[model samples]
Target: MTQLHYDVVIIGAGAAGMVCAIQAGYRGLNVLLLDHAPKPGAKIRISGGGKCNFTNRRVEPKHFICANPHFVKSALARYQPEAFIEWVERHNIAYEERDNGQLFTLEGAGQIVAMLRTELDWAGVELQLNCDVVAVIKQHETWSISTSQGQLTSAKLVVATGGLSYPKLRASDFGMKLAKQYGLEVIPSRPGLVPLQMPARQRAWWSDLSGLSLEVAVTAQRGPRFEGAMLITHQGLSGPCILQVSNYWQPGEPISLNLLPDVKNVAEWLLDLKQNAQSLSGALKQHWPKRLVQAWQTKFEFDDHLANYTQLRLDQLGTSLTAWSIYPDDTAGYAKAEVSLGGVSTDEVSSKTFETHKVSGLYFIGEVLDVTGHLGGFNFQWAWASAHACAQDL
Candidate 1:
């Protein structure tokens, strides 16, 4: 049996752990960053389809959902997205701004991982990959961690072991379990930014429309609204708009989709088209795919020609087109989720330092800390900001 000691031991090598480790090491702390996986930044490597959306140009407290809404403000303000962009610039990692202010690598996500690894190396942080922690025991001032390799002790233990999202990437509930073990409150966690699954009948209908995508506005019942491209998948709804609304969606809640968002007054538009001797299918085909129009016509008993419909019928048709309501059976689950919604309750940790109120020298950050951001680069920003906050305290 071998034993090791360090000033800080971070139990995850994902976005938060790597950033925290590098920052702590730069502060002259002997840091040991460990992960069960053979490689660090597995999520980063696969995020944004391997390009890695590192951060967003506009990040605010309103963009995040947490048990304690104020928990993310301090960290996000201190370490803004511009700071990370500046850091990436320093590393000479060429990146480009994409839709919705998302910043992605020009080459590949590997460059972001490499840049972080280089920073860790230069800061003298020891990284131990494929080291699965078996046990964590705290006795007085020292924290003892038993891993697959050996026993280790640290003055401070930072659990950046992110929430259960991508299990294949070695994501686990270790952080939440540890929090509960220490008598800390943990919020119920679920999939966020994941595709919604439709009911059996709706699924069958949507399956026929699979591979079809269109721009629209989506809103969840009693939740936020997002306007972007919505995709019909074999299972149900997806794409940017659906993914964004999925964050706030709860089970049994209906989702409303405005199919004709650009058309303010559907009845007026249809009336004018009728005056122009246009057919309903023809007008719809101009905006929607031919197949989609055909399928939609089959589902809804709408007249083929606008002239055949009365004003009352047109008004009803307009209402249906403007607000197409859908009830999702469930989400795609953590397997397909971009991030987990809840974990260690933010009320149990310091908003400024990420240090647990119940456990001294123990911190929690990233997706495991009950802080979930909207779709796009907000989650990555939260990871970097929270990691920076915890590292500064360490």
Candidate 2:
């Protein structure tokens, strides 16, 4: 057996691991970044349909979900979107801002990965790909890692294995397991930014409306609301609005959707329609697709003219339109999830340095640390911020 030594050894060469390696290497430290996957940044390559939403123009603590709400503030404040944007600018990567300030590469997601790889090379960071980690041990404040390639030792170890979402990409719970092996608290993981699955009985109805899209305001029970484009899918519901609300959605919880988000008062609008003696289907057709109106009529059986409905019935119909609540059978699951909801508890690690308080030199960063971000590039910002914070301390 041969032994190699480094000042820092980072597991998982995804977004956080690469950035941390580059930052630490620039400090003149011997840093080795290892990944079991043959290629680095597999997730990055597929993100945003290969365009890669790298960061958002506006990043705030509120954009992240953590057990400790304040855990994200320190790192996010230290490394804002502007810092990453500046780096992107330096690389001369062609990028464009999309809806809600999402910054994405114009060429492809490969540009971001290539830029990170370039940075790693420039910083003198050693990258080991297709290396399977066998075991890890700590002695005398030094970490020893046994891998298929060889035995390596380092003073510092960073777990940036990320969360389990894309299993086809070989995503695993290695980080969560490693944290538990060290007696660190681990949060229960769940699929996030995923589509909602309708119950078997309701699926047929929703499936009929598949491919139909509309802007809607949606919220899970006791959760924050989101307004975006919602697409009816063959499986159930999807699109920006459904994916956004899915972060807070739990099983058996009802999701409320304002079908007519632009309408200030549904009851008032219905009354005005009543004044015009409009049929319910005819009124809805003005704002919705003909198929959607037909489906709604079939589901609710309320296609009568307004003249037949009394004031109270009109108000009731208004409520139904404004607050249509539906219970989802489940999420689309990890296979279809954009990210995992939870991992190593933030309480077990230092918010500033991302190092475990109980075990020195053992740190966790990125999605592996029970921190999730909302849609539209917030997650990538967290990866950059958390990695930078950990590297600064290392």
- The TM-score, computed over Cα atoms with residue i paired to residue i, of candidate 1 is 0.97
Residue 308's lDDT within candidate 2 is 82
Candidate 1 displacement at residue 64 in angstroms: 1.0
Which runs in model 1 stand beyond 4 Å of their true positions? 1-3
Global Cα lDDT for candidate 2? 0.92
Which whole-number lDDT from 0 to 100 does residue 52 have in model 2?
97
lDDT of 2 by residue, 249-346 (tens): 88988999899998988888888888888788887888888999887877776766888888778777887888999899999999999999989999
Q: Where's the lowest-lDDT run of ten residues in candidate 2?
A: 1-10
Clash pairs, model 1 backbone? none
